[model samples]
Target: MSDQTSMISARGLRKSFVQRSRKGPGIEFEAVRGIDVDVRRGVAFGFLGPNGAGKSSTMRMICCVSPVSGGELRIFGLDPATHGPEIRSRIGVCPQEDTLDNELNVWENLYVYGRYFGLPRDVVRDRIDELLDFVQLTEKAQAKVDDLSGGMKRRLTIARSLINKPEILILDEPTTGLDPQARHVIWDRLFRLKQQGVTLVLTTHYMDEAEQLADRLVVMDKGVIVAEGSPRELIEQYSTREVAEIRFGVGENEALAPKVEDLAERVEVLPDRLLLYTDDGERALQDVLGRGLRPETTLVRRATLEDVFLRLTGRSLAD
Candidate 1:
């Protein structure tokens, strides 16, 4: 892509950390291996991976808070090593943890963050009002930060990140530990941001979340990218169109796998379930039943990014 169209670009990017051993010299741990990434402007790009997959390390590097160990990284066509301040000024970051001051009220929290960006007093006040309204926190403007719910705190953090009207927003595990209702609310707000043409970079382990928001994504494992593509493309390339989830009695799924191996293109035996990957899940179910095998329950559903991750990594996305 052209430089004008790419928000962030990394070629052979690498990051390492020096760790001191208990009884020996310090050792180096390579957190992010050589990886290439191109984040286009005005698109929501995601990094999907399990914990310790180097997603956070990459995010730190992109935010210019952590120095690059090797290779090249350019944000908005500017090298972070020399232009860290300039790059950070135009980018907003919502880290994995909430960093709001609990002692401060909701409005104060946003107002203080705006001032930290060196915004004028009048401008900061105006922006705080707009952001509170945008995040649906107008009613809680005067409430202490500690009094808000998890969802409310998260919304406040998002609002704070936008005080500078950043060109790009980077979120790490945006909805890590929220309830279903709260998660959807955050998703709706993020969708609105995308519609407004803001470039978003997010890291998440939830396959459903990645499918909902990511225009394109890279799956990382063991500090390396294993696969990269749009959600539908990855699903089509790595998984069947439908998945047949069958559960026999306890400890019976493994024994039944051999009998129904021919029912689908692939069969994966789990502790409590057997997944049959096929184009026609209903036909596969019928075949299983035709063989005089009865399952306690059966569900035929459209394949998802979770299936793709499992197929590629031999592990569940949540793991």
Candidate 2:
């Protein structure tokens, strides 16, 4: 069994799929380019990127569902290629999309899944009760899977993955479609799991979710990891401690962009305004106006992870 120390490790892990088009041409699709990752035990690690960023493919390789085409991969110190079943048996997985058995009631869903792992009926029953409470689904214990809301379905998926009491839990965009209340509830449960020393690995397109939950993470684009570190470390290294925003009063944002270019370590010009990243945002603000550049408004504030991603990738993460 893996202990509480780097349960997941990889070196140059890679996967590619070949696709043939209807136009009569075949091409190779590299879903996950060569990448390295290490997820330590008892902490939440996230893969942050927009859609089609290979986050899902990289996750599959770590979970051992998709065999890697190149390089090394180990979950719990066992090679995924050869120890697939053993590794899987010791890990919990909540996939990107819900795959519950619609025919099963909430309780039966848990019971049936537990039986798949060969758990004794009595053990399954006891664990089912506990899990229902963990996810706050006890009140709807007998509801059919088809009858649950989007949030309830997600919570049930999380509960089902834990039935085996796996050493590691992997969640791929687990709360994508939930309401804000439901999302908060899920976040609270995840925080409790982390506090209890459960190792978690998750992928998400939501920057706020990544910032709120991840202890350490990797930011990916295209098919490779562009940056990796704790959330705060990344912001400090790639961006300034603070930023000054200046909106154009009449002229274009670029008209004032050159004025603040060297006032900060970096300056990014957008359609409506310009951003100056520096240690002292006030100083940068004074410098911009002192240069005779006129603007509608100026706002100074602390740096955020969103700024770091934008500077590194040359575009907003969502767009």
Candidate 3:
């Protein structure tokens, strides 16, 4: 059963594809295993995972662009299988790639997309104006798509997605390939959208991006959800209150790891550094010093979402 208050609901949701080999029988590959998810309305929800973790497959199913192999998925309390068109009309999608038309000017691209929704010429024109202004692209309305910068093109694609004034907006890797300044600009725009009561659905590999944007998030791995919670809750649950990062030149981490094992609750040995997870990073560092171990450098900081990911999956988000 679907939750009416939720924008999206999935129960035992699964997706699979057939892989055919020239030398053998076709094999079935499961991209998404049985999983349950509920995205409440009027909140930003995020999906975080490493590559091939089935994030894209799940997003495609929610957008109704790909059919679910099994289980139930509902959008706005409507079955996507029978109400795909109705569901799509009420949602906007900003894909991973900026699929803008290079032949068209900024305004024309949005105009063409609005027309696809069967919106009236007058309404489309009015919508284009509002969207361009909202995305801070009004000044570039007549600029050729080929002449725009990467950030501009991304913002334009976001504007085009909003031509229908959708109630739900789905963004896939929204700020990838953008500079820090440009990424912050896009983040501001998304923040405004969420404040306006449009539910946001996002997938990102950037831990900081997930922390900043997602009110609630799920961490997926090997086609299944490993954990779910708000950023702070997840950090508190999976990580210590603080982390001490220590560096001791090259090829020294492995040897030093065991030496510092008793300093913190847990110790992780990386290629070039060591992470000590404990409630008091400063105390851990002092313990290390008292043991006559001299680290080249040390940093103590509060635990972040990245720490949570490392603790849960034993892999970096980029992996």
Give all TM-scores, in the order shown: 0.97, 0.90, 0.96
After the best TM-score superposition of candidate 3, give how far the Cα of residue 21 lies from its true spot, in angstroms.
Answer: 3.0
Please write out the lDDT profile of model 1 over residues 268-299, one tens digit for every residue. 88888999999999999999999999999999
Ranking by lDDT: 1, 3, 2
How many clashing residue pairs appear in each of the predictions shown?
0, 0, 0
Off by more than 4 A, model 3: 1-4
lDDT by residue (tens digit), candidate 2, 136-162: 999999999999999999999999999
lDDT of candidate model 1 versus the reference: 0.94
Please give the lDDT score at residue 48 for candidate 3: 88
lDDT of model 3 at residue 294? 94
- Tens digit per residue, CA lDDT, model 3, 89-139: 999999998889999999999999999899999999999999999999999
Q: Of models 2 and 3, which has the larger lDDT?
A: 3
In model 3, the Cα lDDT at residue 204 comes to 88
RMSD (CA, Å), each prediction:
1.5, 2.6, 2.0
